[model samples]
Each structure stands twice: as structure tokens, then as C-alpha cells.
Target: MQVIDADTVARATPFERLVPALRELFASGAEVPPRQVLTLADPAGGAAVTSLVMSAWDPGRYYAVKVINIAPGNAERGLPGLHASVLLHDAITGVPLALMDGDAITTRRTAAASALAASWLAPADAREMLVVGAGRVAALLPAAYRAVRPIERVTVWARRPEAAEVLASRWRSDGFAVTVATDLANAARHALIVSCATLATAPVVRGAWLAPGSHLDLIGSFTPAMREADDACFRGASVWVDTEEALVKAGELLAPMASGAWRSADLRGTLAQLARGEVHGRSAADERTVFKSVGTALEDLAAAMLVQAAAG
Candidate 1:
């Protein structure tokens, strides 16, 4: 079996290609079982860790499984919080084909999936953006959204002011008009698209702060305990999700439902429905839109296949 590294995966899947590939994959469909998310006690007596196992397969072709470990405390140590690996196998023979660096696949595919959702939901002239995190995934969001929207200006906000400045400087060096925002709510009010990628148990982006016609991308919260946007963010907004699993797993959605501020019937549709033309997106110029992603196994499989093809 071949071993595919992060650099190889990055080279294989760019947003321009991966976004459309994800669109196609969602349109055509695959067999994906509900992913397993388990909380484990840290043997070192630090913060609790999460283990995620996601699996997906295409008939007669391939099967892929991604194993990811998330340690929130790693950020304090100046290290990445996510460590992941993907194993691909031949469906018929059940033979292992490759082992891939899942972190690269996860970040790219996650960003690409957000971009895919934006293609349908974001306003036609969205150029300014507010990024609500300063992590590995947050760094890629600007480029990903730019693929679909005209994104000209970017503002980054984080709990750590210095970290936000570091990300802003990097984006500035890349020729983007970037700024480090000390006030997140003010930034969200003025931006055309607000993309959040934080791992927060509490709400970071409030609904009242979002301007009309703005697009909100929530990528951080995956468990029932994790939430990035408050219940008001969902009120009266046309909401879409990457998959149906988010209904039960995402706190951003669950909290509102529990509070009677939102209902499951209010959901506009899934990304697949949008891709398949079964649902409409951004029906009005001044409509508020939200796309909540909890990650999906099909995306991991799509990204892994792209890397495998590129490596071969």
C-alpha cells in the first residue's frame, strides 16, 4: 500500500477543483453510515479528547474510513488540535490501497464543502468577509470562499488577539486586504459573509449582529456540547446543512430547537438538495442565510480518492 502525505494531498485538491468535485459527489450520492464520535479521558490529565471515525463507500469502487483525534489543549501548546489519518480500500477485494494524512484532507474538504454551500447560498456580489477563528481551518476559509464569491476584503477575529494578527499578516502578505478585528460583532455586522471555524462550547456569533443578506458559515461545532452561533442566528434565517446528521449532532441547531426559537421544519434543505436542484438558495437579495457543517464521511472519501488519483 502507498502512503500519501499532507503535501501530496494539498497538491491534489485545490478549492477550484475540489469544490465542484464535492458538488458532483453530493449530487450523485454515496453510502455513508453515521459517524462515531467518542469522548475519551486524557491519560495525561489534561483536557478531554474526542475521537471521530467516519466511513463511506461507493459501490464496486472504493471504501474509505477516516480516524481523527482532537485535543483542544494542543492550541495552548502552539500545536494543531487535530490529528487524522484515512485508510482507503478496494471494495470488491477488500484490499488496503493507501494510508493518507487525514488532516490535509479534512481541512481542504471542509473548506471546499463550505465553498460549495456558498456557491448556492451567498449573495452574488459578496466581497467582504469576516473570519471568526485563527486556526488551521480558519486560515483556508478566505481562499475557499474566494473561489465562489468575489471576496476582496477579509477581517479575522479570535479570542487571542495576537493570533488574529498573525493570520491577518499572513493574508496581507498574500495580497489580500486583511485586518485583525478586536470587535467581532461589529465586523459581522458589516461583512457580506461571516465564516466561523472556532471550537467553542459557547456562542461566538450572535444572530442580532448579522446584517440582512449576509451568509453565515458555521464549521466549528460538531458535537452536542459544541456551539459557535447562538439561537438567534437561526431565527428567521434560511438554513441549510451539509447532511442530516447535523440535526441531532450540532448544538447550534439543537439549542434553538430546545428553546423553541427554531424548528426542524424551517430548514431550507441539504447541500445535496441544492446541488441536485431540488431546493432553492438565496431566493431574495436581502435574505439571511446559514450553512452549518458538522463534517461528512462522503467528503473524506471524495478527498481521499482525489489524492489517490493524483498520487497514481
Candidate 2:
């Protein structure tokens, strides 16, 4: 069996290509069961450690499982909070095919999924993008969105000013008109697409600040305690998700529903339905849309298939 790392994964499935592959994967669908999370109590009395197991399979091709570790306290040690490994096996015979870097595949596929949704929902005339949070996902999101839209400028916002500045600098060197944003409200209002990937428990992106015709892409906040947008984000906007089940996993949707601020019926549709044209997306050029995603194992499986095929 082959062991694949980040660089190899990159060569296998670039974002632009992965976006189309993700579209096909979501459109066709797969067996995406609920993820399993195992919690380990810290012996040192620190924060509990979390290990997530995500698995999915397409009947004839292959099945894959991802083991992801989340150690939040590691940020204090200047380490990544998320890391993972994934295994892909032949479905019919159960033969191991490859071991892949889960973090790398997860990050890229997450961005591609966002881009895939944006292709269907984002304004056709979108020219600017505001990416909240300067984490690993933030660095790659712009390019993915730009692939489908005409984004001319990119702005990055973070809790730490230096982090935003550093992220902006890296993108600017790549010939992108990148800027560090201090005023998130102003940045969000002017942009056609506002993509937020943050761990903030409280709302960082206000619904009132969003401009008309803008699409809000919520990528982070998977747990019930975490949320990135306020209640107003869904007040009247057409809300959508990667999957209907995502609402159960993402606090961004669950928190409001728990407080009676949102309703289950408010969700217009899932990406799959939209892709299949079973439900319409963005009826008007000036309408508001929101796409919320809590990571799914099927996306990882589809990504692995695309990457594995490319590698072969």
C-alpha cells in the first residue's frame, strides 16, 4: 500500500479540478453514515482529547476511513489543533489500497466543497471576497472561490492582526490583490462573497452587516457550542447546507434552532438537491444565500477516489 502525504495529495487533486469532482460526487451520492467520535480523558487534568472517525463507501469502488485528532490545547504549544490519517480499501475484497494524510485531504476537500457550493449559489458578478479566519482553510479558500467567480480582490480578517497581515502577505506574493482587514463589517459589506472559517463560539459575522446579493459560506463551527454568525444571518435569507444532516452537527445552525430563533423548515435545500436541479438556488441576482457545512466523510471519500485515481 502507498503512503500519501500533503505534497502528493496536492499533486493528485488540485482545487480547481477537485471542485468539479466534488460536484459529481455530491450529485451521485454515497453511503455517508454518521461520524464516530471517541473522547479520551486527559490524565494530566487538561482538556479532553477528541479522536474522530469518519467513513464512507461507494458500493463498487472503495471504502475509506479517516482518523482525526483534535487537541485544542496544542495551540498553546504552537502546534496544529487538527491532524489525521485516512485509509482507503478496495470494497469488494477489503484489500488495503493506500494510507493518506487526513489533514491534507480534509482541508483541500473542505475548500473544494465550499467552492462547489459557491459555484451554484454565489453571485455571478462576484468580484471581491472576504475570508474570515487566517487558518489553513483560509489560505486556500480564495483560490477555490475565484476559480468559479470573477473575484478580483481578496481580504483576510482574523482576531490577531499579525495573523491576517501574514496571511495577506503570502497571498499578495502570488500576485493576488490581497489586503489585511481590520474592519470586518466594512469588508463583508463590500464583498460579494463572505467565507468564514473560524472557531469562534460567539458570532463573529453579523447578519445585519451582510450586503444584499452576497452569499455567506460558513465552514467552521461544527459543535453545538461553536458558531460564527448571528441569528440575523438566517432571518430571511435562503439557507442551504452541504447536507440536511449538517444542521444537526453544525452549531451555526443548531444553536439558533435550540433558542427558537430558527426553524427546521428554514433550510431550503442541500447541495445535492441543488446540484441535481431538484431545488432552485438564488432566484434573483440580488437575493441573499447562505451555505453552511459541517465536515462530511463522503467528501473525504470522494476526494480520496479522485486523488487515488490521479495518483494511479
Of the candidates shown, which would achieve the greatest lDDT relative to the real structure? Answer: 1
| Global Cα lDDT for candidate 1 | 0.92
User: In model 1, which regions exceed 4 Å deviation?
Assistant: 38-50, 71-81
Write down the lDDT of every candidate, Cα atoms only.
Answer: 0.92, 0.88
lDDT of 1 at 44: 84
lDDT of 2 by residue, 40-68 (tens): 88899887779999999988899999999
Q: In model 2, which regions exceed 4 Å deviation? A: 42-47, 72-79
TM-score for model 1? 0.93
